[model samples]
Target: MYLKDVPRTDPNIDPATLLQLARDVLETEAEAIRQLAPRLGEPFVQACRLLLACRGRVVVLGMGKSGHVGGKIAATLASTGTPAFFVHPGEAGHGDLGMITPQDVVLALSNSGETSEILLILPMIRRLGVSLIAVTGDPASTLARESDVNLDASVEREACPLGLAPTASTTATLALGDALAVALLHTRGFSRDDFSRSHPGGKLGRRLLLHVADVMVKGERMPTVGHAASLAEALLEITRKGLGMTAVVDADGRAVGVFTDGDLRRVLEKVDNVRTVGIAEVMTQGGVRIGPDLLAAEAAQLMERRRINALLVEDSDGRLVGALNMHTLLDAGVI
Candidate 1:
């Protein structure tokens, strides 16, 4: 314990005093991240290269609090297109060391660079010939010296008033792990489609991967009515298709406009004979449409901007291909 000026613990600390202390701790940690920004250079790039070249997964290892951080880092890497998984150094000695293959990369995290459990497994990893990327606060520590690439996650000080707890150091290490993952993601050309494949069960995945073709109501079920058809016929098509709207197509099977329930209401207000009115008179000409390749998220944004619930899907030549609405997007988890 150091920093004698600050008390170890105050049982009766006031709410205002506690708030200020929390702010101070946050500011200290923020400064630690800023300091780590400049330290990213060759060693950091080397770690990315090693990971990118790794044919097998990246095996993350750490002890105590660092182990918790390592697990999160592993998850982030795996989700971002970098193959990785975490293994407890303590458990590795018992049996988990088999997870480290010759083609894999080992990222060991230890603030002090002298964790007993991590050091014990060093010889086994070395014998396997797996590349080692060491993350530590001490540049001269044994872990750093022996690593294939050393990332200096050193922080000036800990946010802990006693200066013994791992606070700023762990933050720096976590940030470094993120940097490596993002770098590898960029080098591997990890597109949104690629990221979505790794996360198919969540809203983020659906928004990125779900396309108009994937959810659009295609084939015979698509609501379509001839441009010369009566308004009543269009209404019947809408009802039968259950899409709340119908595409008005010309003789060439090309959509010229769209007629929705809102259009029906307006027609009824002005025209007494709904059955006799032509579909073209009440349809929205050159209406907003989307392609089958457009992402469902993009389609949702367009619908929100245009203030409409449904859109007509058309091919390159203006042929009606499919139909989709807000409900379709919701069903696909894109909304």
Candidate 2:
């Protein structure tokens, strides 16, 4: 039942008491995770090795609250270059055990080390010659002893006032699972590009995978003016493109400089007439150019660092190909 539906211990619960209890729960869970740090040695290393050497997907199995944590662990592993999926232990005892093959490695989770559904399928798992890794609170428990290697996820005590809930134990187990996933990630040499590929629909993917060309205004959409063009002509190009800047190209069509709204403001103050001034005299020489193949996020960082709003995109030959500004990267979600 929801907390609102459950009967209260007292008609009026003190706000101070509720806040203190919440703090205590957090403290207990934090301590439990800290205790796991000292226990990380050979068993943790063996687990990582098994995961790294596995020819097939890592199958995660657990029951109750451990099963919930196992699902998250499986997702974390899969996203971080490890091939993994969670299979319910209850379903595995039915027909889902077929999902586990001899080539696969099984990572099981159990606080008591004796989850019935998981233990029931242990013999079949062993028959398939699958390497089993257990995360358990009890090292001497049946599931822990039966496994090839056990990682201790034991916590001192539950955060519950009654001493029977799965608060601190679950937190410790989740933390251990995270530690395992991160360790495997580092061991696999998983890169940001690898992670972005796995999470293509997310914001990180957009920031990492998107290149300058993918988000730049190109061809007819790009604003450009010849080096010999008047300052007024460059202003027209900038207004037409609405990018606040225009690349000044030479006879060979290579970008030699850039004229921006900022330049116009400076020219308006110093030059007698904007129409009489040549674009080259007023332009910022080779203003903040970027390669079309560079990452858009890197482009954004460069813009922020240089304190400029626009960037001209050039080819390897220094030919003007496109142009973009802070707004372009923002539109592409690179910022």
**What are the lDDT scores of the predictions, listed in order?**
0.90, 0.91
lDDT by residue (221-307, candidate 2, tens digit) is 999999899988988899998999999999988888988788788779898888888998878998888999999999999999999
Which one is best on TM-score? 2
lDDT of 1 by residue, 1-335 (tens): 12344465857756776677778888889999999988889988888888988999999999988999999999999999988999999999999998788999999999999999999999999999999999999999999998998999999999987798899999988998898889888999998888888988888878888889999998998999998999889989999999889999999988899988877887788999888889999899967899988898999999999999889998787678998988889988898
Steric overlap count per candidate: 0, 0
Please identify model 1 stretches exceeding 4 Å from their true place: 1-15
Among all windows of ten consecutive residues in candidate 2, which has the lowest summed lDDT?
1-10
Quote the positional error of residue 34 for candidate 2 in Å. Answer: 0.4
State each model's C-alpha RMSD to the native: 2.9, 2.9
What is the lDDT for 188 in model 1?
93
